[model samples]
Target: MEIIARRIATEFPKTNQAVGVNIVSLVNALAGQVRIGLLIFLGVVTIVLLIACTNVANLMLARYAARQKEMALRTALGAGRLRLMQQLLAESTLVALAGGAIGLLLASWGTQVLVALLAKNFQIPRIENTHADGWVLGFTLALSLATGIIFGVVPALAAASPDLNQSLREASRTAIAGPGGWRLRNTLVVAETALALVLLAGAGLLLKGLLVMRTTAPGFGTENVLTVDFSLPRRLATLPGTPSMNTAIVMTDRVRFFDALLDRARSVPGVRSAALVADLPLGGGQDSLGFQILGRQPPPPR
Candidate 1:
């Protein structure tokens, strides 16, 4: 009928407008959530990197102390300070490069597991979009180089100093008792401890926040609720005005199928009411839009 067709045209446009608004809202929400998740991930990675740097620094310091005799002999044979420094720097650079290569492989595998865990625990939709792309690789490479320089420079300078004779003698007597060496080592240890404390505190705060949110007021009871997901095949997703002759038949069949399903579910023992919903409480994939009350007086400004 002409009337039915006209009514459908109007209703279909409104329905499509609503769906578009919902999709845009969903996308924006998902983007925000993913951004926050990435930030948290970067923070964790940075903390791990700092710990690795501290460990590498400690290892290099120990090696520097043990190689004091070699350094002393080189200096005694008239090796220039600049040459010694270059050699130490080169050695440190080589070690750093090797570590960086190993770290890249580790990070590649770790990133996959990290993404999988995030998807599973947080219900992040379209998680396959997350990957260790070129940017991630570049960032990891830069981080590796920076870490190497930070942890290597101090030990290299100490090892390549012109006054190696006193350091060698002290190394032979007792390395730990050296005046500035103990101070430097203690300072590194304190820094590592502080970083660890900060990371732990952040984790504790996140857990406490989750606990508070979970315990806060949830309006509805969910004791006997059941949920289901409905999806349409791509081939069946023709828009209402499309030139698909079978669209009406397909839509009618789909509606009837859902009606039958609900009827069967309701007929089952212990079933109360059966209703369909676009989203469920605590479901992660849903989003909401903001609205302002109209014709209401504004509150006093603070």
Candidate 2:
């Protein structure tokens, strides 16, 4: 009777070992997927920020044109050109700082909505911990400052220049005499339009790629199908025993739980045949095993 009991114990452990490994692997895969998704989302946000900076720069340039006469009068007075430039730069910085403050408030609210949306779509673990951290705020400030400088410098210099007096006088004359000012404004418009077109083309390509991916065949019948995952605590995963008794216990519980769930599902009316699988089809990871092919050997003396 002791021999029979021992054999039964050994067989039970062997049966349960495979189930535990599958559960742990699935959990790890989900964690990796969540990390990747977060990175992609951040990348998209950075691109949108660049486009916004370009638009803001164009608006500042327009304002600089309108204020050219005032800047010229200031220059004609005791105000040094460098001092005017500094004042214009300071104004741009103030505008950027105000925008950044508003953006921070919006981002705080947006992040909560984003987390809730992700949770509805994916089974992410511990999503409450995801929030905008110090690095994000620091980056936003740096980006805003840099954008202010990039768009402010050229317009400020032009406005404060001595030659701008003649340009402003010509602009105040008949439209035919405003050739130089008109040309400058047209050039700025062309540049902005070209950049916008390039961005639009890139966005179009990305949208097309996403549409293609969505329409591609999944190669599986997903009608009325659902998936479940199980995981063991890290501390209980490893134990000192021959053939790992801890692994056996975890795997047995997972397999039995899934088996009972499947049985209950199948007992419902209009249900079809149920099959147990060790892994999901078309899942995120590769399942590979070392093997020797029948009647074929490796290359000789390579």
Candidate 3:
């Protein structure tokens, strides 16, 4: 960034505004003022992933415990520790991969809806349809594999312990979880619960904000009120005497045209209370200003 800034300064020495490059993600451009909400989504996703990993690990532990007898029998039959570990890890990885496949389908549908919402809210014109491309698929696969390895490592190692006497004794009856296993399970459960609560709170806050935005009045009645858009051509904005577009007479001609339009609208059958509006509530509007503040100087755009 420093090098770029220095180069920019050297190249555009005479520029009045700051000469620099703006570095930002596509999300910033699409989200605009609500860009921070992307961070909220990120936080929620991270927590959700953490919860999933914890749940997977806990379930794997229970599954491995239930299979202690079979594992002991295999050990007694001269099964190698590495082979047992590999087997357990493979099963966990497959489960994770299956879940990832389902998640990918959901993500594809979600991406479409997400893009539509962004386009509508941001008023982006002619946006391309969203789809899960090869990159997204690859990322999901990598994430699933990594998650499986991370979540399955401890349980796989515990189940692969060489000592079979304890497992064999416990296999005769119900298996009891060791202290370390209990601690890991309990800690994961607690952390998952905490993160879930945080996500819930954030969701509630966002929901409340949306409700507030929806309920707020837009300073206009929409019921039975229709807006018609039509452009006033140069001829329409020119008076009968004017030959060309004159700034001084344009306003007069425009007002005359609007009055004629309103009259025509009111003359239509069943039409009442005709009005013209330059801007509508909760819709796009444009305003141009040429002025300077009395005591404050506005900062230049960078």
What's the CA RMSD for each of the models? 8.3, 10.2, 8.0
- Native-to-model Cα distance after best TM-score fit, residue 223 in candidate 2, in Å: 4.2
Question: Mind giving the per-residue lDDT tens digits that candidate 3 earns over 132-157?
Answer: 99998999999999999889988898
Any residue pairs clashing in model 3, and if so which? none
TM-score of each: 0.73, 0.66, 0.65
What digit string (tens of lDDT, one per residue) describes model 2 on residues 1-302?
55555665567755433332223466566587777767766666665666676567656666776676677677677789889989988888888878998998899999899899977776688786789899889987987788787767766665566465474475552222245545655666676677667667767988999999888888877778866564545644455354746666767766677678789978978777666665787664477655778899955321
Model 3: what TM-score? 0.65
Please report, as a residue range, the 10-residue window in candidate 1 with the lowest summed lDDT.
14-23
Candidate lDDT values, in order? 0.73, 0.69, 0.79
Candidate 1 wrongly placed segments (more than 4 Å): 1-30, 113-126, 167-173, 234-236, 245-248, 264-273, 282-302
What's each prediction's clash count? 0, 0, 0
Distance from true location, Cα of 89 in model 1, Å: 2.7
* TM accuracy, model 1: 0.73
Q: What C-alpha lDDT does candidate 2 achieve relative to the native structure?
A: 0.69
Better of 2 and 3 by TM-score: 2
Flag regions of model 2 displaced more than 4 Å: 1-47, 119-129, 162-184, 228-255, 275-278, 289-302
Clashing pairs in 1: none
Q: Residue 41 error for model 2, in Å?
A: 5.4
